[model samples]
Target: MAHQASNIPWNVLASNLHWSELKHPGHGDLHLRFKPDQGKKLHYFVEAFIRNIREHSYTARKQYPEHYNPPLPEEVILDDAVVCKITPTVRRWRAQRKHPGFCRCGSGILRSEETEHKCECPIPIPPEERTAAAFYRRYEPNRCYMFFETNGKAFYNLEIVKTLLLYGEMDTIFRVCAYPGVDLRTWWSMYQCYCENPDAGWDSLCRTALLPYIALNVISCFPETWDSASGKTNEKDYRRMRIYQYMLKHCTKSGMTTEVATHPHRQFFGIADGQFKRYGTEFRGPGLHIPYPYGLMPLEAFLNWDQVVESKPAPADIPQVQWILHSKGLPMELVLEIMAFAGYAPRGRLQVPHDPFHPENREELAKYLRFCWEVLVRCDMMAVALGMAIPWRDLVSNTLVQLLSCVPRRWYTIPDDVDHPESYVFL
Candidate 1:
């Protein structure tokens, strides 16, 4: 969702849901493969170790930096031979969970305990086409925890490690499996300024740039019930926690909210900075504090700070415009023309198609719609389109199921720095 595709084939890339190879501004090119959270459980542990780094959680680091020096690279991961040697328990897990058969009522809605399952929605989606989980199953069909690889060796991994209940609904907690050997802290520190010295540190960044999309690819398939995404880190890592909070919100459709939690701590704001090295005299700390609501779009459009603020409601305020512009990477004029054809006014709310793949859309802006769809597929933002057309079953065909991703309940924003300790960022 964040990089420029210098040599990426948008059309072909959209067609494949399993794996992707894209050139990141900081990481050059990386090959990413998606696996369910079942098989390769040890590899999942490796990623968890890296991500947690300190204060070991079942899904994160083992100890604080002062007490624990992370293990060496050799100690972290097993090569293909060592990994393949161990028998995967995926089959056993899958075997244990029986497919809840479709009810005779014919509603696509899934129910458990045949006699007790209820069907409220009368939509007739085929068994395989049921939920977002089923949509992802089309790709990973086998349950796995996904990881990144280059040169046939594992680079890193990410997975939906747990489901949390928050704001009266379910939130999915995911991690970008970090390891001590790879140095994700290095990647985070230099990410914002890298384009200027981009090529020099590509390898050392551990391909962290591809992480956003890799995350988008995996979380996109979680069941609809897993609404928002949640994260937890110590007070020191709050900035990383906040940045991830925003990234997940921007990449997913509207209605998805994010909350990063930490133990109680008082806010200590001092200095801050804006995009492109614009320093903030307020002096808080440094990493990426460029308060631009949109992740990586052209900043020229938002010179007026009066219009936008860094708050909880900020990220999803407009939704499509910034992400579309960044992901498509099209010339400003071409983007304007496409938007004009689509009946969107300058700086107005971008129109969400009533039916994304509907024929009526093809009759008018045929080539332009095609380009927009390509952008959606490349950025894995099809949920933006599918979300607007809520009753996905009412649409023309079930074929669009393969293009599915996760749906968050509503929206996300940054927690107040004064109140939430997790919102504390550092330099």
Candidate 2:
């Protein structure tokens, strides 16, 4: 077992886990396992967990009061053609039982095992979080990034995000990513329920389990918890983080305490304090969402979009930078146009992550942009960039800031109706 702090309720989770072997590329025959077996203890724990959170969130919603510039859609709309196709796939998946739960065979072996006998239980494969680290994507040195994905997680099997914290710099910070088991369209409809009633969150059963797990997972990674367990007031107004901090420290018996009266910023963090070399790929930039030209190409792409559309899959032996450019990458011209709009003159200083003026000011900026969007939409035409938008020059000195602030979040990347991971990537 990994060493854990005395205050942490590690056993709350440990009792639920069972181990299985995996094959890793760097280190062979490692272990990964599914979550709890169907037991009454887990049932009661999850119940009490949801009750505490529902009370807390209901109170917080009244006090904080979220500000949505534009409200959530009345409900998700699905096309009949897509409904015909996806309904069967979802049914087939459910019938086969493609969830992350652990189910044992009567033969005292696992169902996922490649044995000659195939008599097994409902679950086909376990969630991806516990899988042995194989096919690792290299991140840039000293940067913390998530690698493990607990995909296909839902109300039954809660999603857990795992970040692979690298040596030196990355040890000082952490980040987690999760793409839920619910498909895109289903997510919107279910998300609407959470919006309507905070007491019932985006599947409160999963969320109640998730909050305690985040603190447990982060603390377990850092070896010297006594010295390295650092914390701060979450000064930024990410509303989601506000609930996270409050629930972890006050509601859950995780042993974290907050001194201040204000609950928004009361959060804890752990920074690793040792030197370690874990196997992973070298850094590439974040896997970005790409736009296809399909007639809605941006004004900046000009002639290149036309030519690329004609003879795509451009190069034979493409370099790393150009690998998917012919297929999914935004044209080099579009990249330059935005940088030019931002006034990035001939390799001037670039914005670093955690630059206070950008993401940190997102809420205030969102409010200001909402005001701007309200003004523009009065005339009935809005800017046509229908997905993700990153603005560069706050510069009154720049040419475009005079005209536009941002592309609104509601200009959704609404697909023609299908289910795949990145279809709603823009949000």
Candidate 3:
């Protein structure tokens, strides 16, 4: 005997049989189990989490010595109170003729309000008992809308907000929450540059300095994309290539690679200024424009541009490197050695440094690696090292508390000039 398949549509199946609502079969109604107010539960949990952080902060400041100050309760702000809004994804309204309405006393049938019944059912339904009618009357579903603003408004969905809070950037999160007027995009861009080129400190410095200025200066040069009204387009790749070409000509003082230099935009000739001349015909004469890449410099480039651009210290050499490693609760000595020898800077470089065994290398790379291997791994022995819980995860909370306790409030000082309309930075 052959069986026939059900003629259910995919959209109907998706809506009615949502996996999130159907936790277990034959237990309870799926709709009741996952109500629209579920997001409030998450909001409450985050509130409690912040309370705990505040308590911890207070205790750490009290117990520790001088210069130890926790992040003030006012400084940390996370607003999870999302509004319910009508979403674009709408479906047809359900028919309401099949009524499940019952009397309040559970002893009689409830008809329309005007209709007289044989049973002693009340003429009007109580406000509390009218929920079913209100819920079912709505034609379309509601969606939770989440967003937050900074100096220049930064918006995020549920996943991005949760990820930042749960794993990374607790300080950044709090700082932004507290100071909505601070421009966070530049700081984030700098962080990205750091992640991109961990080993080539000078290269990243130059790139970070130059990119923002270029972004501000050439806002109108890029092509349009997905949403013209919103002014958001997928053009970072095009901008990055343009910046790379500019760097080759001015910063590196080398001819551009064949693939980039010969691209359509490179030879677009125009009248421009020479590098040094400030006066006379040579300064503003008609010539092929070579965008002087060295014009932009990152705020932290303290030494002479020529001196610091090429000979910048590696990340491992920076004093703050240890703080970053410790913040993640990683085995620092081992990780640093591994990082230097293997050239594996997370999000920066892929390979380790070459001179691990050099006598002058006082960083103690090998021994640290051995300690980490034994503490974090070494699964051959049934016995767990460190605590029963994971080492990094266990230490991370304490590390964050420690770091936040000492951090000075600086986000408020960021100038509003970065948020100027001409920059055209879309987060």
In model 3, the runs with Cα more than 4 Å from the true position are 1-167, 171-243, 246-286, 293-427
Worst 10 residues of 2 by lDDT: 161-170
TM-scores across all candidates? 0.18, 0.20, 0.16
Give candidate 2 regions above 4 Å deviation: 1-11, 14-41, 61-427
Query: lDDT rank, highest first?
Result: 3, 2, 1
lDDT (Cα, tens digit) per residue for candidate 3, span 7-37: 1121221122111113322211112123354
lDDT of 2 at 367: 39
Residue 131, model 2: Cα distance from true site in angstroms: 50
Local distance difference test values of all predictions, in order: 0.23, 0.24, 0.24
What is candidate 1's CA lDDT for residue 18? 27
TM-score of 1: 0.18
**Candidate 1 lDDT over residue span 108-152, tens digit each:** 232221111233323223322222232121111112222111100
Which scores greater on TM-score, model 2 or model 3? Answer: 2
